[model samples]
Target: MKAVEYRLPKEFDKSFIVFKEQGLYFPCPWHYHPEYEFVLVNKSSGRRMVGDHIGTFLEGDLVLMGPSLPHVWVNDQKYFEKENTETADAVVVHFLKDFLGENFFNLPESEPLKKILNLSNRGLVILGHTRYQITKIMNAMPRQNGLKRLSSLFEIFDILANSSEYELLASPSYMENTRDMYSDRFSKITEYILRNFHRDITLKEVADQANMATTTFCNFFKEHFRMTFVEYLNAIRIGHVCKLLADRDKTIISVAYECGFNNLANFNRQFKRLKDMTPKEYRKALEAEPMIA
Candidate 1:
């Protein structure tokens, strides 16, 4: 089935809008819109889906999603149970890419904002102190008016555009799938892979899903993604491994196997190739960094 579901704001009097939502859970379904969105999960834990990427999001999760990038935060099953009393809350800011003016982003001084908007096509998870700062700004946006609101918005963009502590959410290939057919096909491929990547996967099986021969699929994937199928699979596995590593209780070897690596040697090789460090080293780096609330 096609995955792109279009969405629109409640009204259209302004170019920029902020929405505060608090409910039993986040109400949006899997959908996309023309305006870019900055979302802060003020209070809740859930599975966040952005483009082809999937991961758990806890309270304080902050993300910037580019225009037309599909996303949703599905609360955990526990949140939906009748006995559950917790609610989900979020602050969302939506603005068009050219909210300032048609030529705004084209100006020399706007280069950084342009780069950030371009990068957001893949979605971005704002991190560390930047995320905390953004939360403060977002919370204050509704109370401010006129130039103050505009200036704060610019500040938010500036911080996000220049920050190093952010993670790209989706693969470049998935974000670049613009054609209807190609978009649907890639979405299917990604959903399948994310669901089954923990198990062994073969090029032959994925090619069959794409309705192409193995060699044809190989060439097609590499041409569009600039990475071989094996490379892409390894990248996905490594991403999951990174998340797993955050849990101090899980051993590195166990995390490797759980992420679909059959052997520690291959896992370490791929991890170093993609992450530039071994699993243990990555864990050490995480521990070394001061925890941000």
Candidate 2:
């Protein structure tokens, strides 16, 4: 159960680097920089692996990733189907944590900002009004220079620091072990779980796949992923349930069985626990959304 490891740069430069990516889907290999990253996904949809957090990311998503956290954005294969035609754009701003210097946190006036950055240790995903503001700022960043760029970058952080609508994605363990095992372990475990979630997967089974003892695997999994093995499995099942609910042809009972629940009652309970809604309610909500091609 090796964890993904990354190296951080030594120096903390005050300036920010702006990157504009076009037609690019897959992110850089699992890696981390010493500098904090503000990412605005103008157009893209795919799975994002940030530290131990895993989830689907849609276009117009905005996130603020803390410094030295292993992360990658994997684009959906559909994006590459036509080869040269697919175009996805992203604006990324990277700056050193010390860019604001020691006084940034020392000053009482900056307490709120410090609190937000501190919260980022657990990994934050900005949404709602704050995300919209950050996206606008990031979109304008590449066209600006010097003091203007600096101001825009600070404004983005200010939005993040003050927003209550954001969500924490990564677990506490991910915050503690910024440099964990190797990237292959994460890929291996993720692929295995995705393939075998419909079947009975025990701790021993997963540990065997990683060539580690069951106990060691549990500790490693919990440390890096911030959840027990069973909890992670349940989350995968719940995600599958969401997909099934969105399909009009699948009945709730059939979906529960298909998702590997042994009993309908247990499935209903778990679904409600994870989703905070009954299966029917979840489907109704999806039905209300505009269809995606």
Candidate 3:
């Protein structure tokens, strides 16, 4: 997919940009920049694309991405409805590798920090205690400026440097071959899928969205997504279905239909293939736990 370039606003007084974002829809689009990014989503639920990785993102999501890594978080359909008042809120930090100094990370004391920055080129999701700690710091970032804010940035870095509670998002292959796909129609195709995935979607329809033949588009999608188009769509649907299953008021059949499954039998089969459990069993498991998906 061709990713768009995003220009982060300049702030000469600050060593890096740390700010809060709040809007009916996230101001972000599918784009990239030259600086590394730290994003913490305090309020929002949506689909996030990091390089070639596409997955569900919910409130409290935290991700770190290296320079020029293409990514975006597309808000769910509910955020787009005229009647919905909920806003997408996040704290984002952007800084260059040498924002501290040209050779700061090269110092012996900064080995761990250097290591994580290398890993972030593929994008990383900060998780567990690390996520919680970082979330607290991100919330206080805007309220504190100058040296205090800079120190908080270091505090987050130290947590990341020592902790193993994280996962890489994009594949090594995607990072290595980004030059070849820099100008692509993949983003256009994904936007179409996000808008229509609540109902049936076909390969032919997606191919048309990309203005490519079905066969050609399928091959390209598999290379970037690590799965076929149908596999990707079902994965997205099942993600939402899991959330719906948490609601005891909705029958499993209704949940499946709402998530785009027309055939009950097919839905059951697909659900099992992905989650290793049938829809009814999955519902029962969640109902017992009493937690949101």
Candidate 4:
């Protein structure tokens, strides 16, 4: 997708911005900015797209993204319903590499921080105990001002710099050229796929969305997603299927059809291809050893 560039609102007295943002759901677009961002998803469940990667996120999702790294958090459809009452909230911090001073982080004392900041170009997901510790600090940032706020930020960075409990999002190829030439063309197609993946989506349909010939679109889809269009769509459908399997109340066959699978045989085949297990086996494992988080 082509990420729209945004200039974050600024305050006269502060070189960075930090606060608690709350709303019915995240209203941000698929966008990027010059400033580095640290976001702690204090409350919400959604799918998060970072660069060319897409995955699910739940409460306590903490990530740090470097400048110009495209990203967005789209809440589940329920949050957007007019009658829904749940709120989405997060602690968002934005700053520039030179926010303090161009040479401040270059000092010998800041080597670790500089190293991690450089790695943030790929986007980092905070995990383990470090995630919880930083969550507390981020939750407290909005109430402080002046030097106190800056101090808390530095503390968070120090922890992140020393920690290995984190995973990098986005592929090396995507990060090498953050702005893909065909990005603008892909945006419309990505939106169409996400919205319609629950149903049968044909090659001609998606090709029309991209305004390209079917053959050309086939090559383009493979290049962009490193998978055939059908493989990509099935991956999306399977991702949602895994989530539904967590709730055993629904029958496996019903869950398969609800997620757009037309036949039980094909659904079972695809499910195993992606998850390395059948839907029933996946559910049985979940029941035996449920995730604590």
Report the error of model 4 at residue 198, Å. Answer: 32
| Residues 160-231, model 4: lDDT tens digits | 888989887654323332332237888678768778877989999899988899999999999866689888
Error of 1 at 11 (Å): 4.8
Candidate 1 least-lDDT 10 residues: 284-293
Residue 255 of model 3, lDDT score: 89
Q: Which candidate would rank higher by TM-score, 2 or 4?
A: 4
Judged by lDDT against the true structure, how good is candidate 4? 0.79
Give all TM-scores, in the order shown.
Answer: 0.62, 0.58, 0.61, 0.61
Q: List the residue pairs that clash in candidate 1.
A: none
Model 1, stretches more than 4 Å misplaced? 10-13, 177-293
Q: What's the lDDT for all of these models?
A: 0.78, 0.70, 0.79, 0.79
Q: For each candidate, C-alpha RMSD in Å? A: 11.1, 11.8, 12.6, 12.3
Give lDDT tens digits, candidate 2, residues 125-170. Answer: 8889888878888899888887888899778767776778787665
Clash totals for all models, in order? 0, 2, 1, 0
- Please identify model 2 stretches exceeding 4 Å from their true place: 1-14, 82-84, 177-293
Instruction: Score residue 112 of candidate 3 by CA lDDT.
Output: 79
The RMSD (Cα, Å) of candidate 3 is 12.6
Residue 223, candidate 4: how far off, in angstroms?
A: 28
